[model samples]
Target: MSGYLALLGSSFEFFCLVILDLERFALAGQPHWDELEATLQRLENDPDRGFHDLAAAQRFHYLYQRAASDLGRLASFSAETSLRRRLEGLVARAYAELHSAREARDTRWRPLVWLLETFPRTFRRHAGAWWLAVAVTLLGSVVGAFLVAADPEAKASLLPFGHGEMNPSERVAKEEAGRSKGLANRRSSFAAELMANNIRVSLKAVAFGLTWGIGTLAILFYNGVILGGVMLDYLRAGEGLFLAGWILPHGSTEIPAIVLGGQAGLMLARGVIGWGARVPLGRRLRAIAPDVATIIGGLALLLVWAGIVESFLSQYHEPVLPYWLKITFGVANLAILGAWLFLCGRGPTPED
Candidate 1:
């Protein structure tokens, strides 16, 4: 009789365990069912929305994964046919939606779309930092230029490669000869070298932010001084027009890229400094990662375009194209870039 009683007690406990498992499964799936249904409804109502919106897409993905996990759990333990069926259907729908979105993003034009829509929007969010970088560089250039203009002796310290040692006429002659040789004889090699050097400089500026942005600032200041000194020397030599023609075409793009790189570095530095300390240092750095990537990507594209222009159109074409024409080309390029940055991807404002 005791043995019979023990078997009965064990069976009862097993039944209770099964009942508890069923309850847990139902509770787990209930919330996910409601959310999945709502999200599906929203997606169906607005087919054009959600997929491109990063937040919405992430939410949908999260909900989908939850629903899928619930489906698996219910299939394994739940005897309720209706509950399992409902969850299975929801999972199927979500899988389809996610797959479709993924396919759409796989299109070739998706990268261009990202560049046009995402890059600028991200950059605009950090416009203050970018503008600060531009201001610092411009101020440095002005100070350097003024110093060179005020004191001839300052040229030796500011100018690279002892350019200060050359007399005005000698400097002018050397500049003209270098330009002629590069353009007339070694245009391809010159362009390649210039592009490589410019890219290296921009990358250095961005990487130097690891030093808390001091390295970045120093690079900008040093380059600014070199530019100012060279400009002054050319102007004094009465070759101002020549300088303008030679520099503007590539400088318009190259300089802006460098500034953008500096801006990225500053953004990184801000993350490192933890100005408010509201978030942990690691979190702050992670937050700025996307912005840094966008800025660097944009800078790289600009550099490639600048390199092409510098090599093919800016350097050797001076003999074929008048200086005014080259200047006009530079202006046109700048205008297009400005419009793209400021205006492109900004659709019509919704009616308030």
Candidate 2:
């Protein structure tokens, strides 16, 4: 038993060293990728080892398998370092594929659906900081709402924007009514317009991620403050129940989707900023391709959902259901999103 334990410890140590070595090479200006693959292969040969050696051995084996499979992709190319170069080729191919898919009558929906399926995992893996920012913003809004609700006098000036004497909520109602009337003639166009606006906003959130994420935070803060002010206004009007009708109907999906878009922006930004040292151009592109695909794909899904909510659900501003029922629907929406984000297993990361 002592000998077995000793062997297990040594094996574990070796396994760690192997991983560190691979990581180091990957971070180094010139990655010794072939060497990493060789090490993984050797580790996997230790079949005689028992449970104690399982963890390290399995890791090495997995890395080795991935490297082998990825490296083998070179057969399709005539260039040296074909696997890496081929990955660099992704930008043009992706753009063309997506564009062509959209233009082709039979293929338009397929490309969009593909993007929806792949983007969440990438965003989830690379968006830790941005996601935290979103969480903080949401939590702050909730707390601020409760505070305003407690003592109206304490927050008499809570809403800073002017309603020109109509009061905040009344102003909003008038504006909303005007917008609805303007949109009455073109429902499909309105949905498309909203979808385009949402996509543009989400893309900007991700694109600015290249700037160390400060830009993303600024955008999120703007949104949070606006929401907090609206909540305060609603509570002030003694219309908490009515507010639920306005928000809970479609906000359940819309709000989360916006947050998710922010997260995707952060992920893309990390790649642009070289989360690890700038990789070989080929290696870098290969590493980040899947993530780019994920962001675009996720936005497509969000647009569809947002269109449904905006066109159908949001128009019905009367809370037909009881408070508990509305709350339940809100909870259910969050639960489904949570399952997709954290619980669902897809490859090693969400994007895969």
Candidate 3:
């Protein structure tokens, strides 16, 4: 009986040593796993551009295969259950990333095809989030319009650059003159500036979502207030028609892009806030990252188009182009955008 007891004690000690050795091996591989994950994340975020990094791709492949082998060894040897589970998850993720990257590489125009097809489908799938963002912005705009209309002094606090001091007529006159002198004279520079500004605003809207979405909402609301106040001021100055023509030309595309940016922020907020608690927060964030990139890319393209219209077509008032024609063109452009987004990619295809 004493010999049997000694034997049991020795076996327990040996088991402990095995655990320690296994732990050491796991720890040794952790940094490589982390580096592989980071590279995978970068590739996932911008798959089209990321595939160009051949070194990173090779590194990921090496680490992934190594991880798979480790996982197999751990499973076969009956390693600690916890460590085995972790390795399993790591191997699964690496496999998915490797598969996706390989598939993307197989299709040279996959990015463009995704933009044309998969992107719209993805956007439509999240239409509820987008519309919610639009509703918030519109509600803010209405509140702003009512406030400025009810209390003329409110404009002082709302409008930027002391523009509130100038009555509606002065504001309209200045805008008209600026458009004529700046946009008409230096179209290229003006377009570039406008595009840059819009891009900045859109980026801010998306970035601020990291703060649990409050920052994004605040930005959208403040911009809405400024727009509403400006519009009311113009209408009060009896330049309603002028304001419509001035804004609609570019506003058609620009407004939707801004709203989409807000939507992206809201999605980020959803992940950070862990809305459903069904999935792990980290997984939720990973799932949404690609969608956020797609939305931002679409917004950038839309802003470019808007900048062009604002710089060229919108500036041509009176004899150069009638207000009626501008409004018609704006409506037509919006219709085209609507059709492209909702109907263009409905055919039977994997991307669609």
Top candidate on TM-score is: 3
RMSD per model, one decimal: 10.0, 15.7, 9.3
Candidate 3 ranges with C-alpha deviation above 4 Å: 1-112, 161-163, 170-184, 349-352
Best by lDDT: 3
For 315-339, candidate 1 gives per-residue lDDT tens digits of: 6443466788888888888887777
In candidate 1, position 314 carries an lDDT of 75
The 0-to-1 C-alpha lDDT of every candidate, in the order given, reads: 0.77, 0.56, 0.80
Positional deviation of residue 13's Cα in model 3 after best superposition, in angstroms? 27
Which ten residues in a row are the worst by lDDT in model 1?
Answer: 101-110
Tens-place lDDT digits, model 3, residues 190-230 = 88998999899988999988999999898888878888888
Candidate 1 — what's its lDDT?
Answer: 0.77
Going through the candidates in order, what is the number of backbone clashes in each?
Answer: 0, 8, 0
Q: State the lDDT of candidate 2 residue by residue for 1-352, as single tens digits.
A: 9999999986775455445443332243123344443443442353223224667546544544444443443334354464456333432333343344333324224553444344444555665755675875686576556656665553545444341123546644564455434345576777777788777766676666667767875666555654676677676787676567556655776666666667765665566666566586456645766566566666567667777666655544433335555556656766876676665445453223
TM-scores, all candidates, are 0.66, 0.53, 0.70
lDDT-wise, the better of 1 and 3 is 3
- Comparing 2 with 3 on TM-score, the higher-scoring candidate is 3
Clashes of 3: 0
In terms of lDDT, the poorest run of 10 residues in model 3 is 176-185
